[model samples]
Target: MMLVFALMLCVPAFACLAMAMERHQETLFGALLSAAASRVLRCAGWSALFVALWLAVAGKGWALGLVWYSGCTSLGAGIVYGLLIVFAKRMSAR
Candidate 1:
């Protein structure tokens, strides 16, 4: 259950982090975001990731929680990367 929650939080956290980038902004949102918006997304992304780490550590012991966080972060990043590629390809096709 805790792992699942951590995974859920991680996916969006990674998404936020990716979308914070100017390169990803156009691919994901079809336009580049303003500097202020990018800053906010970046901050939110880091904060959410921290919260997810806290949730994991609090729910499980330190060693197990760190392990779970590592897996979640990797999986979440992979998922975001896949989606970005798909979206970029789809936009280019049209």
Candidate 2:
């Protein structure tokens, strides 16, 4: 259950991180984001990732929590990357 929570947080964190970049902003939003918006998203993404790590560490012991954190981050990043590819392909097809 705790691991699941961490994973959930990680997914959006990665999404925010992706959207913060110019390339991903174009791919996802169809236009460039303002510099301020990008900065905000970048900060929010890092903050969420830290919160997820804290949740994992607090819920489980350090050793187990760290292991689960690693897995969650990897899975979350992969999911976001896959979604980005799908969206890019769909946009190209249109």
Question: How close is every model to the real structure, measured as TM-score?
Answer: 0.93, 0.95
Candidates in order: C-alpha RMSD to true structure: 1.1, 0.9
* Predicted candidate 1, C-alpha RMSD: 1.1
lDDT at position 65, candidate 2: 91
Tell me the tens digit of each residue's lDDT in model 2 across 1-94.
7667888999999999999999998888889999999999999999989988988998888999998899889999999999999999999999
What C-alpha lDDT, on a 0 to 100 scale, does residue 50 get in candidate 2? 92
TM-score, model 2 to reference:
0.95
Give the least accurate 10-residue stretch of model 2, judged by summed lDDT. Answer: 1-10
lDDT of 1 by residue, 1-94 (tens): 7768888988898898898998898777779999999999988889888988988888887999999899989999999999989988888999
Error of 1 at 74 (Å): 0.5
TM-score of 1: 0.93
